[model samples]
Target: MTDILDAAVERAGLPVHWSWRIEVRPRRRTLGLDVLPDGSIVIAVPRQTTPEDVTGVLRERRLWLAKAVRRREALAAEHPAKELVNGEGFTYLGRHYRLLLVDEQTAPVRLRGGWLRLRGDAGAADIVDWYRVRGRHWLIEKVRSWAGRVGVEPPEVLVRDLSTRWGLRTKDRSLAFHWASMQLSPDLLDLVVVHELIHLLVPRHDDEFRQRLLVALPEAVVLESKLHDEGRRVWMGAVRAAL
Candidate 1:
């Protein structure tokens, strides 16, 4: 359906640069715009939807799409592409560490003297994998700490590179967290863990849920607002680059 979407974009005269992919799925009930981590768009619709229908929504949301593009471009400018070379910086635990490529290091990644002393042969993917490995352990520990305080047993915690969420709680009470959570400050990370652990008792973001969340962690709203403003600036594109 690329031709259909392309034709619609031309007809609408939208100045979008990314190639928007039109996907007709079997179970989709409504239309939505998805900005991929790699700065692409996906228009997901129901199986039998027409290009005309998609075009109408696109035109209607022209302003929103424009804002999305501006936001993406701003982020791109703030966090330009990394060459993964020596002296390049990466974030860990909300602190910046400059990379120092070494020849005889055994570990793929390590921190020394305010520097991320990485093996000269290792690449960006290797650093991301290292973060993922360390993130799993940190998230598990945080989950256990918060769950204990909330009178809930810790569920199965796993870390993966998520595109748009910091953490998710499944129906079975198991939890999954984005590896990018490791880059957030400790307070923000605590908020994320507390937010998800509260999901065990309250499934929705209702008033009761908010109250309970505050009872567990008082600074939820304030910190979450900051996180919204600070946003998930997963800049180096490690999440998508490794994928």
Candidate 2:
């Protein structure tokens, strides 16, 4: 199956530079193309689908695939990695703070005196825990405000590593946000909160959803574009090895 898909993609004249793979889905009914955050491409197909069909879909969406891949590549290039050293920068609620190693502290990490103070023995996990703790506290209030405006009951909010997603609305109506989102500015973070709240009333990103979102956030389009640009620079827990 893999060889067949590879042959099909090659025959379709798609760019060879792309890192791509094929996945057979037993329950899928149609072909799906996914460009992941790290610039890898996934071609999902039903078990009964032919290589010819795969080639046709690839050919049809060639331009779109190229654009998506390029965007992912650009974002990946800009993704930030931090070193756990004195004077190293970190962001919270869009404000930049320098990391300061402290000999002794009550906690593993704390943001005080405009500095992200980390215990000398601590590492990236401590910083991540700080983000999660602070993000959860901040998001809870923002979620309540947005939920009230959207006229829906506020769901339980959690701040954790969401991988490729900034926010998620689960089937149980719970909302979870990426801890990295705490690095975004307050306005942008509000956009994330409002986005999930709107999803509670409208499940899909259709015309109705857009209308509702615009009504709730007049600057939704601009903020979304900014989020895309700024989100790329957020540190997703990658750390430089100590020299």
Of the candidates shown, which would achieve the greatest lDDT relative to the real structure? 2
> How well is each residue in 1-243 modelled by candidate 2, as lDDT tens digits?
778878988888877688888898989999999998778999999998888999999999999999999998886678866889899999999999999999999999999999999999899988999999989999999999888888899899988999989999987999999999999999999889989998888899999999988999999999999999899899999776668
RMSD of each: 7.5, 8.5
Model 2: CA > 4 A from native: 1-76
lDDT, candidate 1, 140-230, per-residue tens = 8888889999778899998887767889987787998887678788888889898888889888999988999999889888999977765
TM-score of each candidate structure, all chains considered together: 0.68, 0.70
List runs of model 1 lying over 4 Å from the truth.
1-72, 78-80, 236-243
- State the weakest 10-residue window (summed lDDT) of model 2: 74-83
| lDDT (Cα, 0-100) at 124 in candidate 2 | 96
- Local distance difference test, candidate 1: 0.79
Q: After superposition, how far is residue 33 of candidate 2 from its true place, in Å?
A: 24
